[model samples]
Target: MTRHLPSRRQALLAGLALAAAGCAPLPRAGTASASSRQLPQERVRAAAPFPMPDISVPDFSASRRFPITDFGAAQGDQQKTSAAIAQAIAAAHAAGSGVVVVPEGVWPTAKIHLKSNVNLHVAKGATLLFSERPDDYLPAVMTTWEGLECYNYSPLVYAYGCDNVAITGEGTLKAKLDVWKVWYARPKPHMDALVALYHLAAKRVPVEQRQMAVGQANLRPQFVQFNRCRNVLVEDVSIVDSPFWVLHPYLSRDVVIRRVKVRAHGHNNDGVDPEMSQNVLVEDCVFDQGDDAISVKSGRDQDAWRLNVPSRNIIMRNCRVKNGHQLMAIGSELSGGVENVFVDNCHFDNAGSGARSTINNILFVKTNERRGGYVKNIHVSNVSATRIAGGVLSVETDVLYQWRDLVPTYERRLTPIEGLHVSNVKVDEAAFVCRIQGEAEMPVKDVSLRGVTVAKVLEAPVSTVNVQGFVHAA
Candidate 1:
């Protein structure tokens, strides 16, 4: 059984009292639905059994701490601090294992490249404020943009081919977003560049030759990325503002992100994106995002098929979402299969400012015919929400946003999705209970819902097309 938290009523009372006393208060963290809190585990088990990896926090108690002050970094200088951090990382690498410390001050810097067996620890009063100039991330490195691999700007914090890495301590990692906010709009040049990159990937061009960041591509790099690494941990950090998706783990394994709070309201600011990875866990996190709170993805079309990796064995629990498009979302770019995802014991608080105040969806799984993938054995249970704009559960296979007219579909391939289970989910208000649409040739199948209750629903109870073997009870 999932452990339930305090009710929304209690949280609301606390907030009101704090407001009366002229103190800022947190939004309500709701409790699990009473109808589903005692759901049986067997009803939500996977179709086939698989082994879960043992993921844990790294131990750095015995390692030496290398402070950046020892390497000529001042509190207000960007160039000197950036070079000093690189030197500290090199020193830690030479020492086999160590923690590079950023002491209590506002340190302005450029891109930080991480090495193996090193922890970038920002102390309690420290803040790493990244530069706003796009050229600071110039001389493109090997990275991916929207599921396609290319050479682009380096991420703010990047780790490539490393192991046993971490970013911990009670401080903030922020972005100076003067340039990135303007780059959000998709103009003609950006569209043309996207089309060019897609054709390049489809023709199996070398990653070196598939260079982005040319002719107004505007592919923003992630805030922090771990590419082709293993055994990672990111804990106890407050990330406020990002260039793109925050905390992305791509092509990695055995990752854990716990007790991390993120508030990124810029465009494409997903709190955490686990792409083409395996054996991950995210727990005890608080998110206030512009996009999905947590989005699970595999990869894009031909590139994903060539790489042939599936994201599996992921779990999320005890998380609180203040505002987002969805509390949890699956890909529109999942050509590489996704499976064995379990989410439980979470709260979605959708109390926002004006008439647009609500979460778009509680849970959403989106794809299109051009995305050829397989999704199986996804289970969500024991969740509660308030003020949802869309639906409690939504599965659509025609979500082509800008690519609909930007690039023509080279090959039409439908995804096969099955074995989805949801139980003990309750919502105070929503547009619909479920809105599911699938392809006619290959319909979504084997879905089960039990003990789902809603106080008020504006739209239909369930809206579906091309779905089979669906069962709903009580």
Candidate 2:
């Protein structure tokens, strides 16, 4: 189901609300104090538009179908259906290239790992329900969590080292939330395991030696992940209640996620995380997420420096976000680098619920001193938002979370960010139009904002520190 954009009347109401709250617009380009010499009028510059990526989904014209029902699998029987589905996938893989059909029913299952040239298709009116038992995902697979590599629980649907893989159908992929909800609390054991994993990753231990599924690690796996795969496509699926990140494509290339709907308002349930992957496109999607709607990430710390693969040529367009922290976020784990990202013609709905009842920001770039990566060539344009509780744009360099106090900064590496452009954007209400805090030594540079309008802002419209060549012009 496609989400509808807010009407002009709604936008007007939002503007009126901000005005009633006594919010005012900031001064335009030339009206800053002498002490704020860094934010000069000449600093604002026009940005050249980035070219749209040329990407397409793979053609499966010659593929045959391998239906699960033909292999003795019935609905509601978790164990039997899970095995039967696996068998169907194997059969399709063995047959060169084929589609594995999941018929119309609520098929409860365990973990499902895809092979090359396999398309897992769930038919209309069907739900691929995952099991609530933790043991179902035992014998951990090689996966990354927050940026470190370790052997953790297998994702609900995983594809590793595959080619021409797709999960395309008009059906739902849901998680049995009873177990995952408990794991979200991050108890003592979970924190301890996280710290232990950080030490192992920082020390540059072999990935195979960093086992993490045992003990109380309880590291929640992603709902679906394509790891080190190429030519991947995920479309027309309604995902609900993810255990972790909803859709993750790590170290993959030529990936496309389009015409999808994700509603996973659980902890760490980012709608889509394109990590260390290149040539990616996410378009025509709807997201109601617990975290950032779309987060561009690379590797972390030593692990990232070893791989040295940056996430580039990523694009998100024609999307709508009902609830999210940031419509688009970069980093906190971007050690390898994130560049050449383009977001266009998207809408963010500030009408959220519970703790996120107020939308945080439309775009946020967060990194810390410990994360040594670069973020560049980010272009966002033609965006609209009804309301935002926080700043419309924020570039923070000292956003250290739990790791700030938990673990000491073993290596003091700082990121260099530049070439950010936001143009032709509109918002009805916001706390601030821009809030940027760059490092003293490594200041952010070359940020340009043009043709942007915020009807009302409660706080200062533009706030900056140690930034140069930042232009704010209508």
Candidate 3:
């Protein structure tokens, strides 16, 4: 039933097959003009050596010119603990120095606003406990979600619009264990303090002179959110009990998140949501979460329809994902598109019950019917998965999660997906569903598997494939 459907894109992409062998070196900051900033063909660029792609650990161990603090201050003066830490950050950022060490024991604070160009390293036994009181996280900061301008509740450890940042060492960055996800998806009356402050900040009121709206206890609080930053690194930190999403990197570039551990029981608490970024590397991380682990997004359907920016050039290698909905996702919110990505050398291990747990795998693309954008040029390889609730691999152009009979059209869909490759993958057990489904008319191209092995399958049915060469385990 293959018909020669002629179209503008089919004609163009007829010659634009993904024979893309290598990647050209990343351009220096000032190389490309605003007009030629991004190459359209760059979308097909194969996974090449980014040559230490924009992340490195520069010996923050010995360069501890910054003073250290012990939160075990015998005097219960919150001001002393607060002032000493604030001065340390200011001094560290001022001196172009590194390491404001939070070494051992619990350091409780109302709000500890992080600064630019500094590393907050915590020792193995140390814990930075943030005050549950919402008033501490005041002074509305500049941030964005889905690239829209709005006064949203920011993170506990907030850094919006900075560069060369990090949070290193093995310890716990603890938020109030019981607060949970109080106000992220919805607004509350008590959150008027944060809202009013944002309203005032939006009105261009002076920060110091703005009225302090208090006694409110509602606002979406992420454990850590670094927005619109570059060359960022988050390494070797164990985070627990976040109020909302654990680590959110929104609208950033050239970021590396390594060896971080996240365990939380809050809803929508994804380990990392890399929204609208380029050249991102998330490796060697362990996530046991409440919602989808490390889901990637450009924006939700409607908002994403307008701001059609893709999450491109992403690599998640050597990571372990357990207790989460599909280890790596093209997204539920794929308004723009996701292209040229790879998730290799990862493991999926888990028990049973967490809100995020599901058919975890290396690749899970489900944007059916209400398609906002496309997911193209994806690869998953060298992975071993066990005890998955769903399938080893799945691709959907329509959703079975909720409503049906709604076909997302051209005006709705942002882009098209093509060029998918999977190799050297093994799945021990899938107790439920696993399959691939694209729009009957617009079949996904270049989808293949070279040494995939699967067993103990139960739910779902799969059939149609458009790839040229595909091999499956017997």
Candidate 4:
């Protein structure tokens, strides 16, 4: 359904040929615009093989500024800065609409909670360095670990049930990873705690009662999470380090993350994770991540099914990745279905990397039998990469990392993956072109590849176990 004309010349020729054959020419690019902003929503919708909504971000041009320094925040003191930030946020929220400003200096702080119609704007020469102490985020807040919902440590910047929130500026939001670096190691205690949480979620325990900040749970908090919010925008910020996933839009809607730069190399430091969210757009971002550059996820098994909100109408374009496991990954935690995702004009530039640092794949769709979600209408086009360590495309149905031995499967429901199309993807070197290991009962369906050229193949170009309607074109 999705078509990619690699170059302008190709597009022109294709249009001319279609006209000569008396067929309607391809729809011109950028015909439909969203709101007054210049985001190419029309192009995104055109690329998608399904219906996509017009995504828009919060506009704060008329908001007043409430600087943290005005509320007794100093550069060296953490307590004073944290209090000042809270006070500034309160003042801004009370003023109907405002921007809580962190001005030009290194400001140490703890958890920052955003309210509705508030913009947390860090100025050009400023850095909001989050504290490393676990106590700084104490008094557990409602958050998710991996994909399960619980009350845990609050993210560094947390937004809960707020509308029209924006975190925009030309500054940096960094984390002090002294304690989190140690928590990255999944010891026996950590694994046990995860199993306990899994059991709790499977049994449908109250989310408020599932406290995980106690004991050796070590479930590191995310850097920034828009939890249960609407009209979110995070733009032009440089994120350095993170405790977990860098930018997370969780159960939020109408989100836009653009012109941002992230360099986080922690345990599971994905760049931007849009989980259980709809109408999301991530464009013009540069990611140097420890995990996938952009991971599309819904909630986990039982928790996701209870919520029943599928992640859909998402688009990622014009992004660059320096280091990652994959350019984009869909679900190892997707139980609440994911569909209508379009990734275009993205590139992975990992040329000067060591062997262990090369990307594994361009696109990886992974789900196990425990996850009952469905993945469909995934389209990727015009993606180029320097080198891929594994393959260009991979769809593995039995990808349970540690849960296989740690805990028993409470419910067995296989994911239905179908309608995956990739076109005009050029990689310098790769282990293979495609590797699909689908289940016998429910094979992956309707996968097609066109113009997927790899310069060097370290292994077989294509491998499959159980797949239906598979097509490949050089």
Leading candidate by lDDT? 4
lDDT order, best first, reads 4, 2, 1, 3
User: Which 10-residue window of candidate 4 scores lowest in summed lDDT?
Assistant: 32-41
For candidate 2, report its TM-score: 0.88
- Model 3 residue 211 CA deviation (Å) reads 16
Q: How accurate is candidate 2 locally (lDDT)?
A: 0.83
Candidate 2: tens digits of C-alpha lDDT, residues 379-420: 899999988888768999999888889888888999999998
Top-TM-score structure, candidate number: 4
What's the distance in Å from true for residue 175, model 2? 0.5
Task: Please estimate how well model 3 matches the true structure, expressed as its whole-model Cα lDDT.
Answer: 0.62
Deviation from native of the Cα of residue 438 in model 3, angstroms:
2.0
Model 2 misplacement above 4 A = 1-48, 51-53, 350-356
Per-residue lDDT of model 4, residues 1-474, tens digit only: 122223565446445533332222222234412222321122223345678776656677877899999999999999999999998888887777789999999999999888767789999999999999998998787799999998899899988766677898999999999999999997888888889999999998767678999988888999999887667889899999899999999987789898999988888999999999998999999988888899999999998988788899899999989899989999998999999999999998864333256579999999999999899999999999887788889999999987899889989999999999999999999999999999999999999999999999999999998999999998
Residue 274, model 2: lDDT of: 96
Clashes of each: 1, 1, 6, 0
Q: On a 0 to 100 scale, what is the lDDT of residue 32 in model 4?
A: 19
Decide which is better by TM-score, 1 or 3: 1
Rank candidates, TM-score, best first. 4, 2, 1, 3
| Worst window of 10 by summed lDDT in candidate 3 | 17-26
RMSD (Cα, Å) of candidate 4? 12.2
